[model samples]
Structure formats: structure tokens, C-alpha cells
Target: MLKKEEVKKVVRPEAPQYVKDVVEHPPFRVTTNTTLETLASYLRKFPIDVVPVFKSIFSEDVAGVVYPHTSLLIKSKKLDAKIGDFLNPPIVVKESWKIENVAEILIAESKWGAVVVDEEGKYVGIVTLRGLLSALALKEPKAKSVAAIYTPLGEKKSRAGFVKAIERVSKIFKKLVGGEVDGYVVLSRENGAVGILTIWDFVKSRRWYRGAGEPRPLFGTRVTRGESKHTGVVRVWRIMFRGVAVATPETPVEEVAKYMATTGLYVVPVVDKDQRVIGAVTVWDILHAYLYGPKEGREDIEVRKAIEIVVEKPTLETAIGIRPSKHVTGLRARDVMLTDIPSVNIRDTLSRIRKVFLRSRSSIVAVLDDGGKIVGFITRRDFLTYIAEKSLGYWKRQKGKMLILKEQVAPGETVRILVEEGTAGDIMKTNYPVVAPNTTVEEIAYKMLAAGTDYVVIVGEDNTPIGVVTKDELIKAFKERGRKAKVGELMTPAEIATVNFFASLHSVIKKINAYELDGVVVTEGNDIKGVVSVDDLALRPIEETLRGEKIIFFTKSGVLRKVSTGLRRLRYSKVGTLMAFDVMRPVSLNISINNDVGEIIDKLLENGVLPVFDEQGRLVGVLNKMDIVKDLARVYITYAMPEKVAEVKEMEREIKQS
Candidate 1:
């Protein structure tokens, strides 16, 4: 166990003066006026999957929302389309407030929270729902859903007691599957009551007892569908800190990584002195910069002149993840920042913010002003605060505990009593803690630790907050800045290395290695779109690797049954039917191509698919897996084509109108 102070004192050598500054990452904002086509192009440029939507719709004082996975965006992008109209308000926030405030607001809204304006109407940072949850994971009490009270089913049972044993297990399984008492039971095989088996043992079924024969696959009567639907409709509500982070042009590189890591973020959007997201510095880039300093140094003295002390033009495309993490431990600011990123207007919403966050896995919403300068931050936490405050107000009104504002009081008569009633304005914090890219650990750590707040808004020399620095970050840097005797510096502009969206995941993977990267920036021209990370492509299952030629069958029980002897495949329908004769192998399961779900799960649980096959073996479609869950997410529905989908557009319109 480590005390907060103890954690703060172990100065990380990598976090030298150089790390405080940065190189490059991603830009924060985009305009609502930009068409969805433009936004889709951005999605292909980055590794993230979500972006924040900013700007109000209908000339109202709020920005609405949009998502990439929904059919609305995907359909248009796949066919070169755009969002014809705005949907919802964007998540907004002020830079001065605590990050936790955003978490509170999100919970109250029962929707993704949006951090809007203060009473005086100043734009702040936008926080996502997950951003709030991330902060809460570290600094707040957490809630966990309690499932069922589980107990082991005794293994003791007699051959006569087998029926009873199965019954108990079934009851428990039913409760869990039925969504009743959320719990599971252990399975067991009791020769009598004394012999016991666990639920784990039951699920790990090896070979059931056959009266006088060798082990054989159990035949289930049920059948199921194997095809998955990628085109189904889904509802998605996403939030992003649709903004960027700013640092003084001179901030150190190591400190920049420290700033980003403490917030549990990988990319810190770097801004110029003007508060523009000029570039970005990622953890790997800054780490490389720090390591650049300690390599066979000629001498410790003359720190600025030390060999390889500064990082120049440090694009991942150049260095990639080439050097070991051990190196680049004390390099300078000039070594790490990638100058070329993207930028968007604050009024831009629905496209970049929601999708970029999804691809980059970053939380900060970099708010940029009219000149493409970062001026504010939008974090998930900010949204939570707004919703919570509003929800509290709603409840107060319901309980008649709400206070009337002085502004709403009558002007002429004695409205002093009414004026005494307060408004949410009376309780909202006017002064919130924030930092700028140039702010040092010592300067900001004190504020963060004292307040127990994690997110700090990063501003520029102009006093406008451009990004954010959390409490965790300040502590990390403050402790580490003291250890190293030498440091590095960087000042070159950063550049992005992008790939075409239509490129195969394989091609993207190849490009990553060429760059020696953990991820690649997917982009179009100058705008950011999406990001592709190594992790994103790592788990893809390869076909033609299932070990051997396979055979499928359905048992009387309706479960998918596979029987393989490393030679041939077989499908069976019924056990004692005339179709069983002259059969080289028995086909167990049968299937149909229709899209009904409830009918499928029931058939699958029986054993495998249904139906008996003919001698000619000309067959219909088969069933394998349910797309119910897949349809819930954003996926490319393959079996159903797009043209066939448009016929139902009227249904979509009707629901929207209703």
C-alpha cells in the first residue's frame, strides 16, 4: 500500500524539465457546419472510436450530439452521405470546475452529461460519462451491482438421485437466465448423495456415460443460427471532451507526458502560446524523448549542451515505437511533439468529437476558439456536474424546497421574502481550479492535492484554459522533476502520419510497424478522423485455422454439436429417421435463413438445428449465432445489404416523428 504522499515523492527520472513540454497528439474541435461526410473522413484518420459533439442546434444555446456506429452515420459515410439535421445538444463545461463535478451530472441525467456554461455564460471544458467514471475510480467511493448468492451443489448423489441433482442445477440456471435472482449454482455428479460435482464441473462436460460403448458426442434436439446480422438498428449515446489541451510553447516534453499520464490519458493535445492545438505529445513520444538524454552522455555538466538532449521533429512516423522504453528517459521538449494534428471550430459538433474519442481513447475535449486556438476544455466530468446540479434542482422543486431567485422576484412591492429564496446560481462555484500547458507541477500540484480534484484545465498565456491537468499528473511530475541532473528540450512542429480509410486492417498493421508505432493516425488531408491501435487489430480471428476439417450436427437437445475425426464433415437431423440410412455420417442439426430470434434460441437449446436432409443433400441456409447482441453495437451487417434496408426508411421516420 502506498500513501498519497509516498506516491508523490518517488520522483520519476523520465519526468525531467523537458517532459513538461510536448510535441504532438490530436486536435480538439470541429464545426457543426462541417458536413457528416467531412466527419466520416476524420473518423478514418484516427485510432479512437468516439468524438464529442459541440454547438447548439436551432440557434439555441447548446450543441447537440451524434454517433459513428449508428446506421445514420455509417450509412451516409459508407455511401458518401451526411447528417441532414442536428440531433441533440453537445456536452459543455467551464474550465474552472472540478472533474468530479462532471461525473455527478452524468449520473443525474441518466444520459451522457454535458458541461455547459456558468451563470455568467462562459464556455468551459466538456467531460464524457466515462471520464467521470474514470476519475471516480480513483478518488471516489464506487458502486457494484450485487448478483446472486452462489452456493455449491453437493456432489453426493445416487444413480436414483440423478434426477433430483439435475433439477436443483436447472432451477438455479433458470433463475440466472430468466433475469430473476442473479446467481449461479455449482453442478455435480453424485454416484449417490456423497459423490459431488460443481457447476464448473457440469459446464466442463467431457463425455456422458454411455451404457456400453466408447465416448461419443451428445446429440441435442435444438438447433440455432450461425449467421450474425451487422445491419440492424441500434441506439447509441456517446460523449467526448470534444476539446484539446494547451501548453506554453516552451513547456518540457517529459512534463507533458507526466501531465497526460496522470490523467490516465495517452495523448495530450499540445497548444501554442495562443491557445491553439498546434500539435500533440503522446506517452510513447515523451518517453522516447526522456530516454534520448541518458544515452552515452559525453558529460553531465553543461546540461543544455549535453548530447541528444532535445527531441526534434519527433513524429511517430519517424521514430515509431523503435527505441526501448528504457531509453528516452530524460530527453527534452523539442524531441517529442508532432506538429501536424487537426483543428475544428467550437460550433462544430456531431462528427469529430464523438468519433475521435472512440478512436484515440482520449478523454479531453479540446475547445478551440475562432482562430483555431485552444481556449477551453470539455471533459466527461463536466457533463456529470451539469446534470447533477439540474437534477437536484428538479427534485428540490418537486419537494417544494427549491429557492426562488431574486431576479425572478416582483420589482415594485416588498418581494424581499421571495428574493430570499435562492437559485442554483447561489451554490455553483464561481472560481474553479485549472492549469495551462506552461504551468509547472509545483504550481498546480498544490491546488490539486489541496482540493482533492484530479482534472485541471490547461490554459495559455492569455489566461484562457486550453486543456486540462489532473491532480494525479501534478504529483507525478513534482516528485520526478527533482531526481534527474540532466534534461532534454524540443521545439520542432509535430506532423501526423495518416493512412487511407479504405486500407485493409492488414495494411494498417503493416504501416504501424513501418512507423514502429503503438497506433496510427487515420486522417484525410488536415482533418483528424480515426485512429487504429495495435490493440484494435490484435484479436482478429484468422480463418482456415480451426485445426481440421469440421462436421456439424444437431442433437435431440437442440445444441450445436461438432464431431471431427480429422477426416470428413457430417450434418445430422434425426436419429431414427429413414434419412439415417445410407448416410456416410449422421447430420444432427438443421437450420433456416429467416431473421427471427426467439424461434432460433429455442431451437438451438433443444440440441442443434432442425430438419432431415435428402439423399441429394441440396440444403437450405444454416443457423449458428444470434446477432441480437451484435445488432446492439455498431457493426457491418453482411447478410443483409444496404439497398434492402432502405425500404424500411419509412419506419425509422415514423418512430422519429412519434
Candidate 2:
């Protein structure tokens, strides 16, 4: 007879518990044939991120899953698309699956959550990252404690002052680098109350810049400032996100972690008994302190490797060997094609084309002739390539031509390079990929990968352009299933390119153009704080500026008026006096690398980009929609259709010989 302690260790120590034992039963689902509109309604009405799709009303089997963003993307173009048309690869796990094994699969697959099914393949319940984290939080060591893990504000607490410009606070972040804190608790400039300031707050405060030599939007109209007034200044209060989540020195580590996870904030400021801002503790610190203990130094484990270690419970089988029963068929081109295609006219300017891409949140655009026929296609890559190879020379030549004796500037004055502008016709590629509405998903997949293009024009039988099949659309059509790519495979690693929130707006824009990226992850030294997109750069609000200042006085009659200080101040008032913080949406969505390609697509459809992080809560990379389309297209061609490709090549050879 074994003792109770020995029995407990033998039964549950090696392999903790099963996911089914801890899954939440969300009372919302739709059948396989649910209408797109109905699915959209359910998604909007429910708090669930994804609605599970069942095989039938009577069956317990889950056919697939649909998310709000995926539905919205489809309805924006194909209003008739069914829930079945956009179902993600079903991520069903056995009820007996160990929690560690289940978490491994979820992370490896890049899933938002998993649907736990019984031995009979009946849908039992769901387990999301929140649930997983909650479970993991319970396991955190409580003995060695919060004070050992958190960094004390110490002397810096008193340094938190008001009236500091953004430039000054940025210097504080630089000094606090690698000190266990990523943000500071700010003291109000006027009231002496404690506030919070992070690097992301600074990024959100960036003024809108619409390229050089373009008029900025004022009130509602575009206005150009005369040559004399250009004052560039960013004040601190303008950029910092005002509210702060605070913790007391004596609070438990588990309590802080729970708060951080719930709010999706990485750092929390610690306050004294009277609620004075003291120091802070970052997610990076808590993860290191709580998980590995204070003795262990931070290590850069590959996200997958990290998941395998932290979630290293004894498993009966590996995830790759787990074969699912269902197969996806009847997926059509029209079902996933984008009909709300952005088109550029031959007469459209370069600036206009740029705006279209920015507005559509797409990289490629079709250029149409007067007859509404697709003549060419333009991509950011094509324009940038052309600009890189020829624009410099063109500008130099144009400047040489424009500069004569009278037009020549004084010694100290720099000559403005006259860049030669062209119409959309100049840069658009004439050899655009084309496909018909009935084109098989495999055919478009192969062609997209082969051509290295993100889109193909979908035309009618009469050769009239109807819609565009983009990589995003094709990825949605494929329904990331058996042997699909992982989020790690598609994400742009943070180390290769990243932007700090403290980086100037000009610097960030330059990095975007330089890297040809839609956005860059805003980091506080390897820990991702948020992301800044090019689209976020336009139409941001600004309040105070060195260029000019306007005071909005409110009357007792409930009227607000903008009164300028003077013409000199208004004229010299900087272009960006106040910046809009909402442009940089918080980094709310994240998936582990083990998560699937379909999960990445769902997030991409929702946020235009998906942030990838490790199990340790550090942001690793971001997966753009184009990244999903281009990369998955290759994976589909390589693994999904290798045998079919060989057979087709053989048939083509035989026909040629005949």
C-alpha cells in the first residue's frame, strides 16, 4: 500500500491535468451552413473571439471556426460568402490531451484557442490563452516573492516631474534601459498627481505627416504654410498615455501578474502607501523572476523551444503526428476573391496611388484604362524598386536642369532636389497575373507563388476585370489545415527590424520606407510595447507646437472657439503640435509560434498584422497579411501540390511532343 503523498506524486506529478478538465463551455456556436450575415451577427453579439462551427445541429463534431474579422473581410467583398466559405482549419483536441500537450499544439499552431472534443469527436469546450495564462498563474512560486522580482523606483520617484517635454522623458527611458522597468510614473505638471508614461504613449502622440511638399490638413481643409514657419517640437504630455495601473510594494507577484494579463499591459507602476509613484515592474521581469527564479539570468530561447520547455509535461504523442479526420473541399476562387478592389486610373498621380494602397491596406493595386480594363498592376515593391534604381538619378538630373545662375542658392542654403513625378502608368507592371472566377484554389496558389506576386486580376470570360485574388484572399480560401505553415514561418523577426516608441515620427516613417514595411513593432529593448503603422501617420490631432499655438476657449453658452496667438505664432506653429494616441492601437492580439497559419490569418484580417510572442510573454515578430499570402502560397505549392505539379508537367510535355 502506497502513502497518500507518494500516490499523489505518481498519479498527477509527471503529467499534470488534461485541457478538458479546465476548458470553458462558451454557449455560442453555429452549424456548418450558417449564413455569413448570421455568423457576423453572432460574432458581434458574443464576447468570444471566434465562433465554433459545427457539422450539423444534431452532431457534436466541429467542422470549423469563423472569426469576426474574417467574416467582415469576406462580406466587404463577397456579401454572399457563407460561414462555411471562410471556416478556419478546425483545431480540435482530444479531451484526454494533457494541458501541456494542448498548450504546445495551440502555441505551435498559432491558434487563438482550441476546441476540446471527446473520444467520439464531440465538441466539449474551449480553452483560450487567457485560460491558459490563468492556469499557469496558479503555478507561479509564491514563497520567494514580489520584492525580489520588482525594481524599486527609489530616487527616480521624486524625479517624476511635470513641465517636461517629450524629448526630456525620452532621455529617461534611455537611462532606464535594462533596469527592469519599461515605463515611468509621471507626476502631473499641474496637480502633482501620479500618472503613467510608457514608450507607446510617445509613439501615439506623433503628429500626422503627409510626405514632404504636401499641404497638411487644417480643421477640414488642406493648407500650405508659407516658407517662413516650420517649428518641429513634440511635448511630453502630448505623447504619453495618461492613465497608469499601479501596484503597492507589498502586493503579491500573482496579483500583479493577473492584473498585467487582464489589462494586456506589460508594465505596472509601484506606489507607496500614500499612492506616490515609486518604481515599476515589467512583464519581462515577472516572467524571469516568477518562472526561473531570481537566480537564473534571462536567456533567449527560441519561442518554440521556450514553449516546449515551460510546457514540458509528459506527452503520449507529438503534435505533428496527430492526424485530424476532416478534409476541406469545394473551396472556390470567387468565394475568397476581393471584389472591393482598389483601382488606379492611368492619370492618377504617384501620391494618389500611394494613398489608395494606404487606404485599402493592400500592397498591390490594379491600374485600369478608360474602358475599365486592367492594363497593369502596381505594388509598393515595384514603385520602391523603380524609385531606388532610377528616382535618385532622375532627381539629380532634374535638379541639375533646374539649377542655373539665378536659381542657384546661397552658400549656406541647400538646393532642393526636384524629384521628377510620373503617372501610375509609368511604374505599373504590364505583365499582371490573371485568373478566371472559376480558377481552382490550387491553380491560383501555384501561380501566385511562381510569379512571386501577392495578387492576380480575376477577369470575366470577355476579359473584363471583375475582382482581384490577393494572397490574403487565397490564404482565407485554403483554410489552413493539414501540414499548414506556422506563425513563426511567416512572421518578420523583431531583431531584424524594430522601432522604439521614443523614435521620432520622421525616423519611424524613414524606417518604414527604408524597410518597405507596412509597420514596425514599437519595442522597449526587445519587449514589444506596441506597433506603429504607416496608415497611423495621417490626420492625427495636435494641441501645442513651437510652430504655432491656438487656444480653444469655451464659452458658458457651450461654444468652443479656436483663437490664434498671432499670425507670427500661427505661421511658425509646428506642423504637429499635438499627436493622436489612438493611431497606435495597443498590442492586444498575440499568438504563440506553435499556433497555426489560419490563426495568424484571422488576426491579420482583424488587425492587418499579427504579433507573435513566446510563452514567456515577449513579443517576437509580426505577421503581415501579405506575409501570410506570399509565404503560404509557397508552402501550398511546395507541400500540398507537389505530386500534382509533377503530373501536370508530364501531361504538358506529352502534349508538346504531340
Candidate 3:
């Protein structure tokens, strides 16, 4: 185990740096009085995403910012209008702000950049994602592994399916737009990381339909007839970009940024030796690293003595082998279901459904029959899909004008018109998944996953809609149950993978990736020294001398062989030189094996893995969210539906065999 003094030696605090050091002059600026045509010309001339709009040139007061995409909302006839009408508020920060603080603000707001202001609120310059990356590339500070910056996908967010799963597109889109993930890492049982889907891919593959009469701006209010049928049946695989660049946990953040810059890829999957994706690195992550160095430190554990206690006592409503009844002992659909669900009559127009969504701020709205029975449903995602299908071309005026004098409108107006004219029954989905009010939360999870939806509707005995359960509710239930369950009940047994203390960094990474282990126990002879997990190894700094170094180690047979650092030399440097003791974190199992899983939930999430120890302080097992979720699901399945036990067992057997 590493001592407190040793742990302090590994901590690297960055020197103070302000945003002014990296700020650059704005490439172009527009005034509020500028014509839309002038703004469009400037946007076309300069390859920039956001343009700062000033209240006046002399005052240098920022009114707002305009994105290149904002043009899609304007009508051709309105091009002469002032640009101020469509301005979005700009994110402004003081020049004295720390780079990391600015990065956090931008990340939180999902903005690409912010306008730098002086103490008096005068515009000084702009700091953008690109500018930060370019500055960091030039500085080339000590490189850190991608693991420190990448976002882990865990079991719930990761997707495994056939490449042609068109129905999964909507779910993936929701995840992307909702900020759940930067991209979807498409996995395969046989092939591992097969492909990746990002927002850029969706933007590039956007197709316009001419059969929808005329295309208008994305936000146009004009009504049109009929809808495009192409988008619904199209396979996502056809649009998914393949053969994307991949990174390993050991890959340096600098290298990942370089790949992203050289290629047009915005998201890169961090895979293991077997090519299975464990996490993803996005442009935003790279910017984060540039601002805040490699992320370090494990969450402190709170020690609690082991005691004999029942984790959960079954009630008559939840007894094993008994049929599930209303309001089970644990969380159920009724407990988390939303009773005030948004809805629209079957005969209501799409315009009405849109109003409900905006007013209620709901993701899904139920389509009800005259008797108040749910016949179908429409989601915000559905509206996005509808817009995508119809906003492909310019809408041409059909009457009161010559062929050359026909008025042109944006796709938004055309799509808006189509939606207003269509009835709820036209676009509402009837195949949505549903569950009974008495259904267990875990069962609802299964249904949502199988149905490729984020929510499940709960109905009463008469088959009338009662409430709705969403991912938010499911997460709340898991957290509550997790707090009551003991670590022993959720942990993976102590038969863990191990590596020698003298092992090369290459070997350590190979072991981790080969077995798909979150980390490995570092051993010196028969005793454990420390643990070297992916997160641990990622925090190790890359030195110039370590690059391309040759490492020689002896095998059990006493034969010594040399290994090159390879192309990713910065990451694969000889661990013997850097010392595994420097990279591995101290292994102190303060978290008791018998303690509630909730005590370590925050730590497990932060470090990605934790070791469990028994009463006598003997290494017993490891605990992670992946194992806990799997166990919880299994337990819930058995308790709620006894008849499915055999089938669930069969599925588990196949999983183990695979």
C-alpha cells in the first residue's frame, strides 16, 4: 500500500494560467444593424461557427452571437432584414478568469466559445474550442492518457446491435441531443467496436424531399400537404460512418486531439486490445484536458463496521414466487410514473400536439380517443424526425406569380405548415411500449431497452393510460435500492486479474485491455503493492525522455528481450523507468465488504473501480456499477416474474459462454 507521503509525490498541481493568455482576436464581427445578406456573406467567407454581433462598432458592446446554422431559419425574402432579429445571447467571460473556469462554463452551456471582456465589460477577444486546441498543440505540455479526459460509456449507455438497426436511430438521436453522450459507440458481440454515430454524421446525411410540395425554413409556419415516408424506413447503418480512428486508454490526449484535427471526426472511441469500446473522447474532452490537465485522485471512502442486517424485507406484495401485485415493496411504475401526462385528442392537429409539448415541457404526449383511452403517442423526437424529412428543399409559391417571380420560403415554414395541416393520428406512433401500473421498475427498464424508447406508458385495468415512467424514474429507483443493498451482494468475487510490479507499461495496458479489466492488482512477490487501473495509468505524465525508449525485461526462462515504445511512444514508455509505484494508486480497502453499496457509489463512479475487503482485511472482491446493475436486474427479474427465471438463467449461461 502507498503511504500518504508517496501519494502526495504523485500529485501534480498546474500553474495558474488565465484565459487572456490564449484569447485571440475575433475573426469577424457583425453589428445589430447589419443586413442578413451581409451576415451570410461574412459567414460564407470565414469558416467559423459563431460570429459575435456587437451593439455598435465603437462601443464594442456585444449584443449577441449568430451561428452559421441560424441562416436556416430565415426566409429568402427576409434576407434584407437586420441580423439582430435572430441573435442568440453570447456567453461573455472576463479576461482575468482562469482557463479551467472558462472551459467549465463553456462545457456547461454547450457553447463552442465565449467572448472575452475587460473589467469594464468591453470586448477584448474571443476564446473558442479551436483556439484552445491550437494553443495547446503549440505548447505541447506533458501529455496525459485519453482515459483522464474520455467519458466512460458504462453498460447502460453502450449499445450493441446489428448495424442496420434503423429503429435505434431515434434513441441514439435523443441521447446525442439530450447531452447524455457525445456519440454512440456501436458495439458487436463478435466484432467489438464496429462503427460510431455522431451528430456530424446525422448532419451530413440529411436529405431533402421534393415530394412534400416545397421546402421551407426549419421554423416556417406555412402549412403543407402530406409527409415524407423515406426517413422512417431508412437504415441508420447506411448513414453511419465506419472505420473511424480509435484510441486506447493509454493513448495520449495530444494524439487524440491530433487525430480529431487532421480528420473531420469529432468523436473517437477508446477501445481495449479486443477493440471493445470502453469510453469516448470528444472535441469537448480535448478542450477540457487543455484547460485542466489530467484528472487525478480517487474519492475518499467512508468506513462503516460490518453488522448483521437484512438488506430488504419482502412484504406480501413482493414475496418471491408470488405474482407481482400493486405497489410492490420496492419501486414500481406507479411510484415514479407521471400522472399529469401531456396528451392530445386523436383528431387534434400536429400543431396542437406541438403546443402541448412546448407548454408541458414533456418528451412524449399521449394521443387519446374520445373515451380518454391512449391510442398512440408522439414524442419531441418525433417532431424532429418529421422536420428532418420535410425540410429538404425550398418552398416555391404556386399561385399569383410568374415562374420567375415565385416567392421562396425556408424549410422551417414549409415543415411548420405540413405539421399544422396533419392530424395527430397521421404521425403518432401506435407501437409504443406499455406496462401495467403494478409493473416493477426493473421490468420497465427491460421493456424500454427492448422497445428502443426512453419511456414506457402505464395503463389501468381498463387499458386506459394512467401514467408514464421514464429513464429519470428508473435512475431514481436504482439509487434508492442501491443505498440499501450490501456491497457483498453486488460485488464481483476476488478472483481478479493481476500484473507484476516490474511489468512494462505496454504489458500492463495489454493485460487490462485483453481481459477488459477496469484495472489490475499490482503485486510484488506474494504481497499486493498497489492497484493500476485504467484511470490510474492514465494519470501518469508523458516525458520527452520516455518517448520511443526501448525496454528490456527477462522472462521466467531468464531470456531478455527488448520492446519498442511503438507509434504511441508517449503512452507505452517503459513503466520500469517511470515505476509502477508512481502510476498505481494506493490500495486501501477502507470500504468494508459488508457496507452498503451506496456508501461507495460516488467513489465507484469517480474511479471506475474499487477493491472490496473482508472483515479481517483480506482482499475479497471488486465492485463496479456494471456488476451492480446486472445483479440488481437479475434479482428484480426473479422477484417480479418467477416464470422467467429459467429463461433468464439460460440467457446468463449464454453470456458467460460468450
Candidate 4:
């Protein structure tokens, strides 16, 4: 794996000293001196996706633009029209702001691109929609996910607190980058909105995601390893997930969600005075308890607590289960127990940990050492990231490296690093930080960035593994599943060999094919470090797993607007497969011969339920629609010379004569 230092060089760097240091100058631009005919013809010939709006106001003052299909030089139109007529008010940002903030503006505005402005308000460069999207990756959500949160700063902060923050950040990453975006924890600088704390800060700081748990709300599944005939077998200690900050068995209707939110864990484990694992809490359970039960439509976060404030603590017999299911009227640690939680011993092989988890329908596997004490846990998603990090192969001949003092990278560094390395482990990281099973999400996000890793192993009192929590687990707290549970209640334990980190790209495929598992865990010795997916490794060509083919469209920004507006004209709202959630906004493509056209076409089709892209990323030309017409003839071949407009008009005139 790439050393944390190497990754930092590309991610962080000191401030640039000069005006020209941060911005790229001489960026491609278009001028007002051009004629409509020439502009239209130029758009077709040029490969760059966007054209600079260059009018006489300032050499770099971007004013307006025109699209590929646009024209005004017709028989009835003026030939001297300038492209400035179509320019819209420019959206600009200072080069000093981090790209993370830039992305927020981009997503909110839904514009073609944003302009980079200097302190003096002079234009520097532009970040197109495609450029911004290329800088970041978006993802679809997982099944049964929620986002519980944690604060980066709290009264408990210290060395342990900082590490906890890193662990929480690693967990949040499960939802932010490759995973889906769920609910988020707002880390206020002073706990009173003094300043904003963002995920990027955690990453730039190299902190790990130390949240309560990933994809929280452990509901079911129990597993037992195959019998060993040797000296009999070992029985691991069942983790007691009590006193883990959950609603009281007697917590009232409204207070449950508020308490769940405070913990930033999906399921808050309920416990008795003995601190034994009794009942469980999940977002799904709370939703049902409130929606279909006594509290019909109250969205208040403190209703259950509200009852506690007014009425005194009542007797358990009367307060516990007034309703038929004994779930809604009152709840406690015992009423919602997910009896047989999956767990294992530290001495167990990593492969076995993988099996116990796959066998159990739970989110993680809990592990104990020789004395049957809880050590830590492992989640399926982190297992996958570990696999991907370890499986990464490099071509030493192409190795290059970039040193970022801060979170900034350039194209040159990427090329240099790729040409260098040869082995997979040469690019993987080891000896990262971890978190405790009981740590709250509020405390873990702060330390995540400093560690530079993406996950935290949740261990029980005796250093025995119980479960793994990830960023995705935190986000899932609110989006779809259980929120009344704690991190231990939801985490997946490392049981069967979670898989190896450096297995041949081919070997992993065979394992996935053989076991039919979700993905194989990648590990070092007995410890689970990472995991590999069948989807990324199943292809024949080894490099196919490394990079993806991309496509581009060259057009003026106007066409992009027209097309996107047309597609969204129906304006349907609701979440389902039918909704084209991944539809593209108007995007400009920088077409070049070096890229794969087939891959681009496939990606386009995969995104929008249709195949199409115009010069300006508009639907003026549909892929399927174009194909049918092409089949009707041989192909769409342009004439060597322009068809005579006079002849065409004369043909219409002759029809009237007839």
C-alpha cells in the first residue's frame, strides 16, 4: 500500500507563494470577434468541451458562450452576431478555497462550470461540470443503511479522544466516498455553531472514521464454526452490550429517537443493572413504534424524555408493556434482544471469521482472545476497502509521486507514481489506528484524518474483537434502518478468513465464484486488513481491474441546459428504480482519440436509461435513435460539399408551382 507519507504528498501541501502558482493560465477561451458561421464550425472541430467567453471587456473577462448546434448565419439572420449574446452571469470561486467547498457550490448551483477568479477579480481558470465530477466519485446506497453522527470536538478530547475522532471519520467514509451519503453529524467548533467542521478536514488531517458503527442496527444471524476433533473446542464469551447509551426499557414514545441521535449509533443497546445484553434498539423499530403505534405523527426528538420530565418514574409492570407486542407503549434492554450475536476467538483463522459473518445475517463478527474476553469486531465494508487497498498492483516502470503539503494534487504527480511500483503490497498501508466498541460517534470523527485510514476496529474490554464499525454504518443510522441499537449490536465480527489483501487478481475471482460470497476479505497473517470484490476483479485482462474507459462531448454550454431541462420536464419525485437518479446535467466532454468510445457509450447508457450525447451533452442526438436511422441507410455520411440552399428552397417553390 502507498505509505501514509506518500499519500499525504498528493493530498496536502503548503500554500503557493505567487499569484501564478495556484492557478493555470492561458486556459482555452473564445472571442467575440468570431462570426456565427466560424464559431459553429469551430465548435465542431475543436476537442475541448467548454469555450471561454471572450469579449473585449477584459482579455480574460468571460462573458458568454455558444453551443455546437447553435447558429444565426441563416438566410434570415445576421452573420456578424457575437457569441457574447448567450453568456450568463459567471459563477466564480477563489483558487484558495478547497475543492471540497467547490463541490458543494457545484452541486447546489447545477451549472455547467465555475470560474476561478483572482483577488483582483480577474479570471484565472474554469472548473467544468465534468472536471468537478472527475475530481470526486458518487455512489448508490447500500441495503439497510443509516447515518448516526459524532462530533470532532468534545469535553472528553485528549490523545484517546483524537484517535477516537479518526476512527469515527473512517466509519463516515463508508458513506461519503465509495458509499452513499446518509445522515451526517455536525461537528460544531464550540458545540454552539462557532465554526463548521467538515469531513474533508478530517481527511486532509489524515484522521480515520471513528463512528459508533457502520451500517448500524444489528438485527439477526448466529454462526458456529465446524467441529474440531483435537482437544475439544473453545467457547468464546458472549459480549454484554448493555449500558451502551440506549433508551430505557421504559423510555417513552418520543425520546427514543433523540437519545439514538445523541449516540450517533443506529441501534442503542439496552441493558439492565447487571450490564447484560438484554434488548436492542434500531431506527426501523423506533419508526414503527411511533408511526403505527400510540404516538401517531409526532416528529419531536424528545417526546419520551418529555414524559419523563412531567410524570415521575413509574413502576416497570405498568410502564414496560402496556401494548400487545410490549414494544410500543414502553421499551427496555430486554424486550428487543437479538439473542445469538455472532462472535469468534482471536486465534481463529481470518477465513473462519469471514465465514461466521457470511453465515450470520449480522453486520459484523465479534472476536475474543484465549480467556473469552471481547477484543474487537470487523465490518463487511471495511473488509472490502482493505482488500482493494491491498490488491492494488503497480507498474514500476511508470512510477511517479507528488508531495502535497495540503490536500491538493496535480496531474503530473499521478502519472509519475503510476509508472513506478510493481507489487500490490507496495501500495498498501499497515499498522493503522483503531477504536473501542463503546466509543460514541460524537468523539471519533476528530481523530480520523490524522490516521489516514478509513475504518476502526471495535474491541471489547479484554482486547478481544467484537465488531467493526465504518462510516457507512454511521450514515445508515437515519436513511433506512434501525437506529435504536448501539455499535456493538450492529457491527460484523471477523470470523472466517475475511480474505487476503494481496491474493492474485485471478485468485480472488475464483474464491468469489466458489463461495458465492458478497466479497472476499483481504488480510495479513491472522488480522483482517482489507477485502476484494468480484465485480472489480472478474475481468480477464489484469489491467481491466485498474482503470475504467471514459467518454467526452464537445459543445457550447447552452445545449447542455436545453437537454437537461427537457429530460427533467416530467419532474417526478419519489425514490425507486423507475426514477433516473443518476441522470446527467448538461455536461461538456473533451473528446480525444486516446480514450475508449465503447466504455463511454456503456457508461452513458448505464446512467440515464438511454444512449445519447451531443456536442454540448444535450439529447439533440440520441444513441439508439441515431442507430435506427443509420441502419435505415448505410450511415450518416456528410456530403463532401454543402447542399445548395437555393436548390432546396427552389424545390419547395416548385412544389407550390405544381
The number of the candidate with the highest TM-score is 2
TM-score of each: 0.21, 0.36, 0.35, 0.24
List per-prediction Cα lDDT, in the order shown.
0.30, 0.50, 0.54, 0.32
Lowest lDDT 10-residue stretch of candidate 3: 544-553
Better TM-score candidate (3, 4)? 3
Ranking by TM-score: 2, 3, 4, 1
Off by over 4 Å in 4: 1-27, 35-50, 56-58, 65-82, 97-108, 130-658
- Candidate 3 residue-wise lDDT, 507-573, digit = tens: 5555544333456666676567766654333222222110011111111110011132121212211
Residue ranges of candidate 3 with Cα displaced over 4 Å: 1-18, 25-49, 56-59, 67-86, 96-98, 137-143, 154-242, 260-266, 287-658
lDDT winner between candidates 2 and 4:
2
Q: Write the per-residue lDDT of candidate 1 for residues 1-658, one digit (tens) a residue.
A: 9777777756421211210111112233444655655554454332121244545333433355443322123322333343436445555555445544443443344333454455476543344432332232232121110001101122221111122233433333332222222111111242212112221121222111111232333365322454334322211101011111223334444333323322223333333333333333333233223323321322222111001112133332122111111111232222222222233346544223434434544433455567766644443233223322332111111112222221211111111222233222222233457655544443343344333233455545787644455422322332233222110111011132344433433344344343333344443354333444332232111111000111111111111122341112211111111111111123334333332334334443232222211244423222211111112101111122334234345545687999
Candidate 4, 52: how far from true, in Å?
Answer: 2.1
Q: Model 4 residue 323 lDDT?
A: 15
Give the lDDT of residue 265 in candidate 2. 39
Write the residue-wise lDDT of candidate 4 on 1-658 in tens digits: 9898879766764332222333333223567776555555443333222355676635766776433223322212465666655455666787666644654564455343467777888776765433332232121111111111111122131110111111333334333332122122221222111111222222222112222222322245322455334321111111111112323343443333433222222333332333332334443344334223322232323211110111133222221111111111122112222234676766554334445645664545555557765555444433433333433222111011211111112311111122221221222223444556545432232223223233345545775334444333333322222223222221122322133333444344344333223344444464433333322221111110000111011111121224543332211111111001111222223222222333343432222212222354322211221111111111111121123333445666798999
- How many residue pairs clash in each candidate at the backbone level? 198, 20, 17, 148
**CA deviation > 4 Å runs, candidate 2:** 1-330, 340-342, 354-365, 379-417, 460-464, 478-519, 522-524, 532-588, 594-602, 639-658
Supply the global lDDT for candidate 4. 0.32
